[model samples]
Target: MVDSGVSAAYPIIKNYIESLGRSLNDLENILLTHSHPDHIGCAAKLKEKSGCQIWAHSPERRMIEETDLQFSVRPVPGFHTLVGGSVSIDQELFNNQEIYLEENLMMRVMHTPGHSAGSVSFRLSKDDALFTGDAILLPGEMPIYEQVDEYLLSLRKIDEVGAKILLSAWDEPKSGAEIPSILRASKNYIEQIDSAINTTCQNGKSDNPIDFCKQVLERLKLPVPLANPLLVKTFQAHLD
Candidate 1:
C-alpha cells in the first residue's frame, strides 16, 4: 500500500483490499511519500494490524515515529484527529535506492523533496509506473511546499525520468500523453503563483508575511481564506 489515510480509513482500506481477494494481513509494506498527517494518518494502525514494515525517506523517519514533534513543528488543524499514532520505520529509503519486490520485479526510489523535506516518488520496473506522493503540486488547490525551487527541480526530475505511467496521490491514475501534460501544468502553476507574487510586490510590498500572502492570493484571484500560515511558507519562498 502507498499511504494509509487516517485511522478511520483502516476499515475503508481493508474493505477495498478484501474486495480484491486480500486482507490487511496480506499487505507487506507501506511506502510513505512524505510525513504529512493526511498521508501517514493510519500508518500506525495498519502496521499494528498487519505487522508490515513501514518504509520512508530518512528525513521523514523522525516525524513518522514522533507524532508530538511533528505537531509541534508542522501543526495543522485537527492534526490529532488525522493521525492514528506514531509508527517505527523498518527501512529508511534514499534516492536511487532500488528494492527487489519479487521475481524479476523491482522498484526505484527518487528523493523528490519540495512538498516536504523528505518527499519521495517510487517507480516500478514491472509497468514503468511512477507513484508520486505530493511531490508534484496540482492546480486549483492550495500550494503547500517548503521550497519553490526544490519543487520545480523535482518536477523536472520526474519529467526527465520519463515514465509512461504516472500515479499521483492527488489525481487519478494517468498514462501516456497525460503525464507530460500534468507535469507541465504543475510547473506552470508554480510560475503563475510566482508571477502573482512579483506583480503584487510591484504594486506594493508588505512587511508582514501573512499580509503579503493575502496580497498575492488576491492577485491570483484565490480565496482570501487561503492565506494561512502553512501557505505563508510557500509565499515566503518567492521572496527568498
Candidate 2:
C-alpha cells in the first residue's frame, strides 16, 4: 500500500510472498477489484517491481493513473465527505466473464458494483471461492458503497453464485453459512437505516447530520460504531 498513513505505506505481505521463493516477477498478473488506496496502495510499486499485468474494471481506469482524483463531502445528501483516491487500470474486465490464468486456474469475473460505480468481484468456480472486493462487509460493520441499490443487487448476486468461501480484502474470510448470513444482515441493516432516515427527515431533523445519524442508530438499537459513516452513506443513498 502507498503511504497514505503510517500503516498504509508498508507492504505487509510482500516479504512473505518473496520468502516463498516467488519473486515479484514470478507473479503472472494482478487483479484489482476497485481503486481504494488500501487495496491499490502498493500496486504501483508492486507492478513496477514485478512487471505483473494489472486488470481492473473500465470505470476505475482513471483512478489508478492518478488523474483527476476528486474528493467530495456531499457525495450524496446527508453523508459525510468521502475521501477517494485515483488510479489508472492497465486492463479492463467485464461482467460474467471467465479468464483463464493457467491450465488449471480460471477466474470468473463478476461486476458487482456498489462500493464504487465500477466495483468487481472475482470467483474461482472450481474452488467456489469468491474475492468479493468490498461489496460484502464484515459482521457488525458496514463497508462503504456509493450506490445502495447496486450494493443490494450485488449481495443477491452473491447468493446466486453460491460461493463456498467468501474472501474479502479488508476482513476475515467467511465460510459455511457465514457469508450468506452476513449478506442478509447487511441488507437488514440497510433497511433499518433507510427507515431511520425517513423518520428523521419527516421530522425535519436532517439539518443536524451527525445528530441525525446518531439518533438513527439509537432508534434502531444498533451500535454507533457499527453504523458508521459507511452505513450512513447507505441510508443517504436510499433517501437520494
Candidate 3:
C-alpha cells in the first residue's frame, strides 16, 4: 500500500487495511508526504512485519530513525496519536518530480509548505486529484489562516496547479467551483487581521489581540468557542 502507515490520524485506516484480508506481504511500498506521525506512524512496525519499503521526503528519513514524545500526540483536535514506532524511508521525493504508478496514475510532487515547513501535496495529472496534506480545509464560511504569507502562497500554488478535485487531509472531495470562493474567503480573513491591527492601533488597546479577534470572529460569523481560548489564540497569531 502507498501509505506511511497510520499512527495518529486514524487507526481505523489500518484496521480497515488489515480487515481487507490481504496477506501482509501483499501490501508493499509506502509513500509518505511528510514526517507527521499520523501519516508516518506504524511505518517501522509495519515494515518490520510486512517488509514494505517506506518512501517519503528525504527530510522525514529521520522520523523512522527515531521516535519522539512530540510525534506521539495529536497537535490539534480532529487528530489523534498513533502507536509508538519509528519509520525509515527507502526513497525521498523532490519538488516538480514525477513518479509514474500505472499508465493512468502518476503523481507530481509539489511542495506546498506552511502547515509544516516540509509539507507537500501531490497532484495526479491525469485524474486531476490533488492530495493537499493540510494546506486547505473544506469551506467553513470563514477561512482559517496559517502564518498569513506562507498560507497565501500555498493557496496561489493550488490555483496554479488547477486540479479538478481538491482532496484535503481534513475535508471530503471538493469541486473546482469552491476554489475561488475559498481563496477569496481566505483573503478576506487576512484582511480582517489588518483591520484588527489598525483598530488596535487607533484605540490604543493593541495589547489585547484576543479581544480583537473576538470582534473579527463576530464580523466573519465564526462560532467563537467558549470552552477554550485556543481557537482565539490561533487567529491572533496572524496579527501584526
Per-candidate TM equals: 0.96, 0.80, 0.69
Better of 1 and 3 by lDDT: 1
Q: Which residue pairs come into collision in candidate 1?
A: none
Alpha-carbon lDDT, every model: 0.90, 0.68, 0.63
The runs of at least 3 residues in candidate 3 whose Cα sits more than 4 Å from the true structure, single-residue gaps closed, are 1-11, 18-24, 59-80, 138-146, 190-240
Write candidate 2's Cα lDDT for 1-240 as tens digits: 111211234354466667887766686577888766556656666666677677878887666565234224223222111213343456688987788877787788898987888888899867789988778755445436688788889999988888999887766888988877888987887776677768877877755556666767776676665545556665667777
Model 2, poorest ten-residue lDDT window?
74-83
Off by over 4 Å in 1: none
Model 1 poorest ten-residue lDDT run: 224-233
Identify the leading candidate in terms of TM-score: 1
Model 1, span 142-167: residue lDDT tens:
88999888899999999999998999
Per-residue lDDT of 161 in model 3: 80
Best prediction by lDDT: 1
> Which digits, one per residue and each the tens of the lDDT, describe model 3 over residues 42-151?
67766776787776676546654555643442243432356446666677888888987777678888887655556678888776988886676444433443455777
